[model samples]
Target: MARLETAYGPLPTDPGEQSRLFYKIYSAYSDRVGVLDAHGSYLAARDIGIINLILFILLPGFAWWATADVYRAAMYACALFSAYVLTAAAAQVYGVRLVENVLAAASADHD
Candidate 1:
């Protein structure tokens, strides 16, 4: 039996029969972490999002302070950082959906 550790506690092996809510939450989290496959893709995307978010908060001000062309170069940098954030977010969402689909297929196979 495969066991899943959740925020509440360890999920029952027979998740579908034991607790629907816990199973759903566990499924979502498992997908988010790419536990089944893609290894560290989810973590990589999360890290990218965090780094871009931090840069978005700090870099614009630093750019403005360093150069008088705040409107041009700073704005461009901010836009680029925003793009990175969006891309990371998209990747995470995609990964989660992919995992969910795989889990669903596996569940169907078991049934």
Candidate 2:
């Protein structure tokens, strides 16, 4: 009988070095994707905000009156919709940085 051994795995790594390298690579990617620029930030912020607003506000309002609230639904709908929209807007604003960062990282890899 013969015994055979095989090794298949990621190579040994230095986590600290790997983290630093990935950070550098991510920065490079961001720059390539145009997220390094102020205009990119502005565009992402505007588009994401508008999308969240429509999805979280105007659309939900109709649903509330049509189904969720049977009495004085319009008022309840407006109130709930407003509350959700404000929170969604805030979160989306905060998320813009992550979006930009990811874009940059992706671009970096493409090169």
Candidate 3:
């Protein structure tokens, strides 16, 4: 597989180093543009819709159908919400990495 190129050379194999390098490049590119802001807004809107669906529809239905207890449903919702937030955060980081790679690739090609 082809390795990703950046200003610092090939992407690091170590997870910690990779994250640092990606953020470094991403910051440089984002400082010149509003890509991060746009992406964040998009994610925020999507999260709002997902949260609404979970709290308003799914939680109520789950409570009525399975638990028949407000407390149990609330606990379940909290766990589910926590998991969703973690997944969303991971997705956001992955998205930023993708954008960073694209920008870095383009910059490498341009130069």
Which stretches of model 2 miss by more than 4 angstroms? 1-35, 70-111
Q: In model 2, what is the error at residue 19, expressed in angstroms?
A: 41
Native-to-model Cα distance after best TM-score fit, residue 84 in candidate 3, in Å: 7.8
Residue lDDT tens for model 1, 5-84:
32334445685755675456446545543454543666667777777777777777777777867696667686968777
Better by lDDT, candidate 3 or 2 = 3
Off by over 4 Å in 1: 1-35, 98-102, 105-109
| Best-first order by TM-score | 1, 3, 2
Sort by lDDT, best first: what order? 3, 1, 2
37-110, model 3: which lDDT tens digit per residue?
55565577567647754665466556757867877777777776776676567557756655755465547544
Clashing pairs in 3: none
lDDT, each prediction:
0.61, 0.53, 0.63
lDDT, model 3, position 53: 48
Model 2 superposed RMSD (Cα): 11.6
- lDDT per residue as tens, model 2, 46-109: 6655675666556555666578765655666566657656655655664566555654455444
The deviation in Å at residue 91 for candidate 2 is 12
TM per candidate comes to 0.54, 0.28, 0.46
